[model samples]
Target: MAVRQRVVAGDEVTHVVLDREWKVIAPIEDYLEYLRQEQYSPHTVRSYAGGLASWWTLLEQRGQDWRHVGVDDLARFARRLRDRGSDPTVLALRPSKPAATSTVGSAVTAVLGFYRYHAIVGGVPAARQFYVHVTGGTMQSRSQYASFLGHIGGGQDRRVIGRRRGPSTPAPLLSPQQIAVIKDDAARFEDGNWLGDLRFRLLWSLLEETGVRIAEALLMRHRDWQPGTGTTAFIEVEPREDLRRRLRVKNQHFRRIYVGDELDDLYGEYLFLLAEHGFQFDDDDPIFINFYRGQIGRPLRAETVYDWIEGFKRRHPLLPAEWTPHWFRHFHATALLLAGIPPHVVQRRLGHQDINTLMRTYAHVTDDAEMRAAADWKMLIQRWGAAA
Candidate 1:
């Protein structure tokens, strides 16, 4: 089996899974269409398509039917994913490292969701084995709160038999010095491409200051930037499309991020440079576009940004090998939290739909601050006792 991208309408793209004869798998396609109808993001649908494709391939290898899969079969599939990898057909010449716990969990979750959807709609039997029902339990006995409509089901509950996930790791942060090094590196004019260098610097500056996702930044237009009266400015992030590429803002919400004079100055400089190169942009034009390579005046792709970071890493061996552009985002949020910004405010800035998500993600930062406060309290008490 294989996954293929299909363009629907004019610019919108979706994914489909194909069998050996290159025919679309009906059940998977139906489920994916249901997701699109429910307004799920295209990126999310693509990921689910890949997971379902892998599951189907595994089923084919074992000569098993989707309607007949049991909990044991799912368990074996999970083991295979953890041991070998996502692609069931490709065997490594040497023992490869297992997939990450989160990857395995996502793959299994996708398969479970596929079966669950089919079970609810088409009365598939396989999904029955994936969930267990509980009818009687006190509110205190329950691990999670029921949904608002959950009481309609006669107080019954269904829970997936899922694998235990590992502990949440703290989000990685870049020090101020490291950020400075990166920005300085990006600002250097290589191959006499001064415009490209300036654009790179501005991109890094925007990400570091706003904490917006790479996609949001890439999809920004000239109209979204609003300069303030003095040493302040604002950048608006909203649901928009890039005509040249399939780019979108993730949350589909309007957000305005506050910025200082430095970034505003950088923006002005970049625009001036663009005009000097005889490239005039309208208000709705993309702010970050390719000037030096690959279809000039088009919005930059996420893959190209990743490639640039990889090349940067290779050139600068002293920098952290694992640092990506997203690290700038983590550093932004962590710095704000450390500086006593409210969690809700940070949540809004980062475009998270829920406050609990922001809290959970940065719980470690708060935990570390509490520990430091306790140490300081102990030191103060000891100092007072000695004086007395």
Candidate 2:
């Protein structure tokens, strides 16, 4: 099955999956339409469509009907998805890299949601078999009385095929030295093109300073920047649309993050370079635009950033091969937490809605900080006893 994008009424886009004969798969299309009606983001609908297409492909290979599948079928499908890149026929002792657990989990979640929707609306009994209801403190119970809402309906039904998520690992960080190297490399004049170099430097600096998401950085407009007195500037990250892509800020919330004088100076230099190149931008114009690539003056796309990261990796083999622009944001958040910034304050700065999310993502950092504090406390006690 193949996924296709279609623009519906009101200029909204949606996705549907097609079979071998190029006919739209009715059930999948129905579920996708439901998602659209529920106002799910286009990206999410597209992802769910892709996941459903994969499931359909698996069913076709087994000659099994979607409505007749059981829990065992889903388990097998999950395993297949997890082991996507590994060739079972290969004889090598070292196994090929498998898909990330989160990727497999997303696909599984899409499939499960599809089945659940069909079970409720289309009366498919197979979907009902995938979930079981639990009460009290059984081994399979997922209830928690920690929160007020959890106490209301904590022992609700649980999916039998769901993957139990483990504690989140510490977010990968870019060391200050590595960030310095990257910014320095980006600032170098490439082919004696100062404009291009300045643009990249500003981009990297903005990300490092504000810790904004790549989408937020790309979607920012000049008007969103408030240049205050010397050494004090702020970027207002608001929900805005891009002319070239359907990118939107996560959580769709407005936040203002402070930037250092260094980044503000970089921005000034970038604007000066832009003026010299006769590319004047209005206040409403995107801050990060394509100055040297396709359709100059158009807002920069996220794909281009990824491409740049790949090229940077090639040029500097010492840098992490898997590094992306997101590492800057992670580095920023970790730095704030380690520097004694409160979790709630960091949450707002990073545009995270929940304080628990900040805590969970950087739990390792907090744990390490606590251990070090304990060591310092012990030393303080020892010194006090010696003085006495």
TM-score of model 1 (CA atoms): 0.85
Deviation of model 1 at 248, angstroms = 2.5
TM per model?
A: 0.85, 0.82
Tell me which residue pairs clash in candidate 1.
none
Q: Candidate 2: which pairs clash?
A: none
Per-residue alpha-carbon lDDT of candidate 1 for residues 1-388, written as tens digits (9 for 90 to 100): 5555565766667889897678899999999999889777787788888888888888877778878988777887887778764444456677678888888887787888798788778888777667655556532232333332455865744545566678899988789998887788788555854523888889988999999888899988999998766646899998875533666688678889989887897898888898987887999988988877898987788878888899888888988899988888999999998998988899999999999888888899888877887888778899899999
Best prediction by TM-score? 1
